[model samples]
Target: MKKIHNYFAIVFLFFALHAVGQTKDNKWTFGMDIAWVSYSEADKIAVGGKFINQTPRFSLAKYMFKNVVFVGSVSTAIGDNQTYTTFDGAARYDFGTSQNKVVPYALIGGSFINARILTPTLNFGAGSTLWFSPKYGLNVQLLYKFSEERFSSQRSHIMPSIGLVYSFGARDMNPRIWSSTR
Candidate 1:
């Protein structure tokens, strides 16, 4: 209960501070996604598995340098007797290849996941954003997470997410960065 309150308060603060700190040259993106998480601990006999679940994921990304974007994402599920959550901080790089309105990017990062206990994991993923307009886009991502058995009981898992994105301070589909020449 208290944790959920803290999360909302932090999110509100983030938006207020971000709005005040925005500039014409800086690009910031906010994404909301419905993520499907597949746990590898599912029964070995079942072909489709039973550990897949859906949750909402929220992300805030800042365009830094030319190809690098720093991202922070959070997802939480509070059940009657359990709490599951994960926080990921990743650096996403945009490839030079972009076709029409589709732009692809790859990211690598670290994550802290709490299933029954808090544990650290290494994460890598690839995703793409399909822009319908200058300010709106559809975002999709897949993540590969790895953890050691010595540190945690849960093994590696894969998460796939699809959602909508809003980009602030963008020129066409690209973000403009402040430079000396400009």
Candidate 2:
């Protein structure tokens, strides 16, 4: 836990320093997330304790509108007897003014999980991003996920994650506009 916290602090500071200006174009945002996951088993299978599972996630996002982004992420669980992976596609809606340093967002998505059984999952969550500059920030999220099998009850999990995001594109482009115009 200490190591993880240190890693997060380093990433935050590195990005904060480099985040200096605003960009005007629609950019692609790439990020890496580290999460502590707690699993609630539906069957008798012992998944493991919370905080024991480390999930490293990678995500790519594009701005679809002034306040909306299309995001896709892939994640896997480590330190478990069973192999688990997930692929998700989600829409994130940013709330509050674009000039705010901290922007909150709500996410809703569908996910496909590959584990002992292949299951489709529903994800609902909310998070916030603190932008040091227009193109660089820190993102933190809490997500609740639900999956059900044909003959079994629904299984659920809580995932809390933090990460760094870097956006790439033209530096002078307006983020709120669909076209490249100042």
Candidate 3:
């Protein structure tokens, strides 16, 4: 798992660095999000302890790509004392490439799962971003992770989940860069 994460991080960094150079001006988009996340768990027959599941989640993403953006965020929940960190370095495109005012983009990246019982989760999802501005918008995500936990025989919730994405940032180019253009 660590190996995959390392490789992904390396590749993502390389691509992000290369992509960032393409922008004529320095631009950034950031936002905060909150949502309900549902988790699945099975009980251990011999141990006599039941596992709890939840589906509430919260996250924030920043778009730092000229044509394609690198998204990074932290996700957390109250159930199972579980917390996850995710990095998505995917290409995002607006319908018209115009300054944001409701644009949708696709996401493709790896998610690293960290928890007590589950063997780390590395999954991928494809979603869209509805932008109100270049710096802010409503993000919708549909994600699926390959389950890798050994538990009791009983069946439980097992499927993909949907997430709400929010971005926040300034619409105007940074003043520092504007001076250089002149």
In terms of TM-score, the best-performing candidate is 1
Q: Model 3: per-residue lDDT, tens digit, 1-182?
A: 45744664565445434431112243443333443334443323322233323333333344454556665554444434434333323344443332434344555554444443333344455555544333334556655444444532222222233433323323442233213231
Candidate number that wins on TM-score, 1 or 3? 1
Per-model TM values vs. the true structure:
0.73, 0.71, 0.47
**Model 3: lDDT to the true structure:** 0.40
- Model 2, 78-179: lDDT tens digits are 656656677888888875333455667899998877765667888999988766666676889998877654524225677788987776643332455332
RMSD of each: 6.6, 6.3, 11.2
Higher-ranked by lDDT: 1 or 3: 1
Clashing pairs for predicted structure model 1, backbone only: none
lDDT of 1 by residue, 146-181 (tens): 877676445677889998776665444333321112
What is the lDDT ranking, best to worst?
1, 2, 3
